[model samples]
Target: MSLSLRPARRDDAALILAFVRELADYEKLRHEVEAELADIERDLFGSNPRVFCDIAEWDGAPAGFALWFYNYSTFRGRHGIFLEDIFVRPAFRSRGIATALMRALAQRCVTEKLGRFEWNVLDWNAPAIRFYRSVGAIPLDAWTTQRVDGEALERLAAG
Candidate 1:
């Protein structure tokens, strides 16, 4: 079972979108996904692209992916990685695809001297929580996530 990780190619837009939807479904947040294929292609492959994705393959067949981007840390005075999405198909579970993807990103952080690597997981995802804990990840229980979007986002903009 040869598993490898590679940077996503322009042709991987569809695969990336599929993974996004699948992950959203898993998190029970499918209704919040407003992304389209064109959005994936344009945002990931367009000029001056800010976000990026890494594809994981098992024996030359795509099995999973990790999408991430750089985020600024005002206190740290440096940039860090924010993993937007990570997913592996049901058939690919227990194959270390997820671990490999995480390792690759962590390696990137080390190599680039990035300040940190971060991602959010649903609180009720026990399995995911266990996996993350096994990876030496800590839960920031003191911090609460906040979001302002849709009508609230529009109102904020107008104000």
Candidate 2:
């Protein structure tokens, strides 16, 4: 099986959305998928896009994707790549696509002298945790992730 990765192009917006939805579904968070095709197109294919994506193709067929963006680190005094999402279809598992995607992004970080490469995995996802551990990722167990969105975000903004 020939597996290759390419930078996502404008025409791949729909495929990217599909991957997002599939990933959300697999995570049992499909209800959290608020992004539509237009959103994907505008954000990922718009003028001066900030976020970026990479597509993994196996034998010329789409198999998975990795979405990421640059984030600043005040301590490191440099930028890092924050991987927002990485998913490989169930059919594509055990093929090293996920690892390859991570490796590719890590390589980019190294090449660009990025301070770090980071991503979050659900605590309950044993398989994902194991995979990440295998990749030399250590959990910041003392650091808790915080978020505010929807009504909470609106309230905070209104304040």
Candidate 3:
């Protein structure tokens, strides 16, 4: 099984979208996926992209992807990479694909001198948690994640 990682290209919009939906399905959040291919193309291939993606292929076929963006940490006083999503197809899991994808991001952090590489995983995802721990990722259990979206997000903005 030959595995390789490559930065996502403009023509990969549909593939990326498919991966996103597949991931959403795995996370049981498919109903929340409102993003369209145009949105993905605009955000990822736009002149000034705010987000980026990397595609992982196993034997020349799409196997997984990692989507991320730059974030800042006031205390660290430097930029860090925030991984929005990392997903490997079910058939491709446990094949080191996710590790490779993460390692690629970690390498970017080292090469760019970024402060940190971070991401969120659901509490119920024990397997993912174990995999993350094996890679030396420690959960910030002291912190809780918060979000405002959909109608509430619009109302908050209007306020």
Best candidate, TM-score: 2
Query: Worst lDDT window (10 residues) for model 3?
Result: 86-95
Clashes of each: 0, 0, 0
Candidate lDDT scores, in order, read: 0.93, 0.95, 0.95
lDDT of 1 by residue, 95-152 (tens): 8899999999999999998898999988899998898988889999999899999899
> 1 or 2: which has the higher lDDT?
2
Residues 1-159 of candidate 2 have per-residue lDDT tens digits of: 799999999999999999999999989999989999999999989999999999999999999999999999999999999999999999999899999999999999999999999989898899989999888999989998999998999999999
TM-score of 3: 0.96
Better of 1 and 3 by TM-score: 1
- Model 3 off-target regions past 4 Å? none
lDDT score at residue 34, model 2, on the 0-100 scale: 92
Name the 10 consecutive residues with the lowest summed lDDT in model 1. 127-136
In candidate 3, which residue pairs get closer than 3 Å at backbone N, Cα or C atoms, i.e. clash? none
Q: Candidate 1 regions off by >4 Å?
A: none
Candidate 3 lDDT over residue span 66-158, tens digit each: 999999999999999999999999988999999999999999999999999999999999988999998899999899999998899999999
